[model samples]
Target: MRGLRKVVTVVDEVLRDVGRPVPVPVRRVAVAAVVRNPWAGRGFVTDLQPEVEALAPELARLLTGRLIETLGGVERIEAFGKAAVVGLDGEIEHGGALIHTPYFGNVLRELTEGTSIIVFSDDRLPAGEPLTVPLWHKTAAATRSHYQTVQIRVPDAPRPDELVVIAGAASGPRPHARIGDRRTDPVVRLADLEKLENAR
Candidate 1:
């Protein structure tokens, strides 16, 4: 809370089916916060939970609020993901510590009314580096078209002793997806069985 610095929001939209009878437009919004890395310069600490627990609710509220606002409220949100990038001064574990908590994702799932478990990824990266956060249908994780990813980079952020944590929401799935679900599709199952039989 005390180290909370700045919040940046990015919204991306694409109309893949530009002039078709059924237009397909996908929109995703990402909100990221720059914060002081509590463990920076303090050396390795066995107990990182204290800081993670303390920061989860605060970061969650701020980032989730910004995402909802950027997407103009949450009803349109179809998928969600979270990411944290720690600076050179912090360990990858420090970055992972932020978004890997149950509290962090649970709050997001509740606020967005998303039934499926939230998707997430975190890493330590330099400024201007891209961070790809994978996402899935909020209510149907197995939906093929709903699988998506949001990529963002915070220019001039996480300056050695900082962290850039992001939360993202999407309006819908990819455009004109016909591949079907790999998990339960008949064709996919047949392909898998064929592969197994051929291997044997």
Candidate 2:
């Protein structure tokens, strides 16, 4: 039987090399990709406990690795940081609540403590340079439902730039459903992986 087909989506991708005047040569990067828990897209649940329990730590690593590669490589990630959450909408009951407790801290601790990066969010911009911290649920609290956004800023830019990562994926019963965005890359599916391998 085929294993549960895994579809990896590039929910968002941002690459910037940090170098003075030349973008600051950002060989290191920090990134976050909020995922719709396959079981908890609507809210939280207890039945899918095992799946939800496993996703946070796994996703934290996935995001970190993706960002590192996009910037260059893992060795380039001199400084690192991150954040993880169960849902983008609200506090959960069984599964979501579990994350907010000690187990969730375990995930955060794994993400931020030993790494060169620091990761967190509480409605405030981080307070350091070369930081790759992520803001969780930045979309749900947004007053406008028109778009889902992630804000990135170069140290010298006059204003932070809000990049639209995914449009219709922010909320609702069909949160995981997709439409299209000229600027966004669709999630990577198993078939894409096969094609990539065939090319080699």
Candidate 3:
């Protein structure tokens, strides 16, 4: 929180799809924090661990807290993900350094009671560009219904010396998701594939 310049939160609700009413609305939330990139303008520092250790957890806590609050409650969140956008002057690795480590991701998982590895995206960009964070089932990685994304953009952020770190959560799957879970799909061996190809 110390290096933060601003925080933005956005929420989206889908009540219908394809001109049909949804029995239950789908809610998606994204929280983005603009923070000073510790390694910015430092001329290629060799070690990034110290700054990451000092800053990553706090940033994760702050963003994840906002996400949980916006979604009404922790239990309401069934899918989650994270993302980071580094300013133009900073290396893409600077953004990756913050969100890719366990320091940041574990906080999100612990807070939401998620067991699966959290999905993520990272990039380097100038201000006002949109980024999409991918989300998946909190406890099941192959639950295709819960596979989704939330787009976020800060009007003025990551001004060549900052990073836009993001966290996303969804209350449920896409509206009227009919595709079954990945686990339900039948497994095909290499031999079976060859047979099918020959038949074709």
Which candidate achieves the best TM-score against the true structure?
3
**Model 1 spans with C-alpha error above 4 angstroms:** 17-22, 182-184, 187-200
Two-way TM-score contest, 1 vs 3, winner: 3
Cα lDDT of model 2 by residue, 1-200, tens digit: 01112222233332331321322222223343433335533444546556545654554455544554564543333333232222223332322333343344454434333321222432212212122234322222222221233333323211111110111111111122245443465678999999999999
Those runs of model 3 whose alpha carbons end farther than 4 Å from true positions after fitting are 189-200
After superposing candidate 2 on the true structure, give the runs of residues whose Cα lies further than 4 Å from its correct spot: 1-24, 27-30, 38-52, 84-89, 92-117, 122-200
lDDT of 1 by residue, 1-200 (tens): 77988888888887756454325577888888999999999998999999988987788888888878777788888888888998988998987888888668778888888888778888777887888878788898888787878888888887899999888888888767678785866654788989999999
**Estimated TM-score for each candidate:** 0.88, 0.36, 0.95
Give the total clashing residue pairs for model 3: 0
lDDT of 2 at 150: 32
Residue pairs with colliding backbones in model 3 are none
Q: How much lDDT does candidate 3 score? A: 0.93
Say which prediction, candidate 1 or candidate 2, comes out ahead on TM-score. Answer: 1
Best by lDDT: 3
What are the lDDT figures for the candidates, one per model? 0.84, 0.33, 0.93
| Candidates 2 and 3, the one with greater lDDT | 3
